[model samples]
Target: MKPEPVILPCGDSALSVELGAVIDETLNGRVLALDALVTAESPPGVIETIPTYRSLFVVYDPVVADYATLAAWFLDRANRALTPPKPGRNWQFPVCYGAEHGIDLPFIASRTGLSEAEVVRRHAAGLYRVYMMGFLPGFTYLGGLDAAISVPRRDDPRLTSPTGTISIGGIQTGIQCLASPTGWHLIGRTPARTYDPNRDPVFFLEPGDTVRFIAVSPDEFTALERRAAAGERVAEAGNP
Candidate 1:
């Protein structure tokens, strides 16, 4: 358990708390704990807390709360939460491995020297890390993929990958929120919408939240799609 958040020269914020090399539940619990501390005992003019996998950005009003003051306060509490807690919630998401959902499945298969089914099997076999979130809302950088499954991203990225596109690249797996350009290989897709603006919190998954993949049949995929199109909130695709 590493203590003392590293203060850096962040462009927008006064002080930053860095908990390096966070994996599994450690990242999520630490993030939540630190956020609680800052928000509760915050100095005057403290504006917001932007938390990541192993860091939190404390943006404050330079007038009321200077950089030096808030930073020390944060360091004090952070050092104390290093004892550790229970692991994060494990979420298993269903995937329709190949064909349309996995447009570049064959590409990954060919490159990795395995059949498409084998590629899917290996991909869904292991647990992954929630390294960081960026490029788009709810988009997470997950680690822990087997080396054999690793493949380079596309040189010419697609213009739009649509929403719920589950793809992999290098050592990370990403899910595109809304429509956006991507270089990751499309291994599968989820009919379930991961983020919704109208919903109270919008995005469902956060940094430090862990997820697993569950394979599904084409018939199940169609059933899930119909439910989603009907305006039902598609979490885990079909109703639990």
Candidate 2:
């Protein structure tokens, strides 16, 4: 049985419920379950909830609900055995892993002592889990990478990394939905817009969802980019 999560004060507007110290599926599942439950309940004065690797941050209005009251409520509900949340939408993104997109493929291959093709194959073979979306809008922190291709983050951070760069850092792998500086090793890129301000739903993937990478050619990537820019869904949804 899992121990009761510790509820701690987070500044003046938020409270953090720590599920565990390590990154594990069961711990993350509990965090998601609590999030889903509260979302469904729609408690008053709740601003928003942010779920991370092993904790959930509950933001609320202090005027409406005091810290003690809110913390007690969270503790009561968090202690109950919550059925794991139903699996969310599954997504498959077509990635171009050639020289142009996979900027650090050769470096990663050299460090791992694996051929470039083998590295790409191992990366594409991962069935990643969306642990949480943060660092940027629609940027998902994913888990479930194959151990063979795991690589450490770069010692020096890049000044700028292109949007849609698929990269790995330590034991975690994620899709960079926005252009930002990062230390992860970029292995590929996708045309799909994980965060589109014009779209009805700005975020393409949510926590509890699953994602897979489908290798595509450079020519195919160009076509997909055009289609995506024209407001089409570049990433296809897999059956739940």
Candidate 3:
């Protein structure tokens, strides 16, 4: 059996529930399960809940709730055998690898001792889990990368990477929501806008969603990008 989680006070209005010291699916699942339970129950004074790799940061209104009471409540829930949450939505994103889109393809292949084509093949083949949305708006930190192709992050971080950049760092891969500085190796580019403020749903993907990459040619990428810019939903949605 798993050991009970440690609950600690965060300032005067928040609580930090430390689930584990390492990053694992089971630990993350428990965090999500607790988040779901809290959401469903609508506990008083809960302002927001942020789930990370191994902990849940719960913000609350101090005026309406006390730290000790909330900590105890969260501690009891975290230690219980939580019912696993329902599977999240699955999304298929079109990715154009190599050439200008993935300038680091050759480098990644060299580092991993695999051909460029093989690198792309392995990357697109895995079904990645959206462990969390963080760092930037709609930026997805994904899990389930193929260990064979896993490589370290770039020694020199880029000043800015284009939106839709697909990259890998350490044992994980991720999707760039917008143009931003990144240290991960650039592998591909996707037309799917994970975050678009003008769109109905500002964030297309959420934590707990699954993602699959569909390889596409550069020509196809241009066409899909045009469609996406016109506010079209380019990524295909799969049933959970």
**lDDT score for candidate 2 against the true structure:** 0.88
Model 2 lowest lDDT segment of ten? 197-206
Provide the clash count, candidate 3: 0
**On a 0 to 1 TM-score scale, where does candidate 2 land against the true structure?**
0.96
| Cα error, candidate 3, residue 177 (Å) | 0.8
- Residue by residue across 88-154, what tens digits does model 3's lDDT show? 8999999999889998899999999999999999999999888888888878899999999999998
Model 1, residue 211: C-alpha shift (Å): 1.4
TM-score of each: 0.80, 0.96, 0.95
Could you give the candidate ranking by lDDT, starting with the highest?
3, 2, 1
Candidate 2's residue-wise lDDT over 1-240, tens digit each? Answer: 787679999998899988778888878998999998889987777899999988889999998888888888888888989666877889999999959898899988998899999999998888888998887887888999888788999889999989889988988888887899999989999999998888767666889998989999999999998988887779999863
Clashing pairs in 3: none
Best-fitting candidate, measured by TM-score? 2
Question: How accurate locally is residue 65 in candidate 3, as Cα lDDT from 0 to 100?
Answer: 85
lDDT at 102, model 2: 81
For candidate 3, the TM-score is 0.95
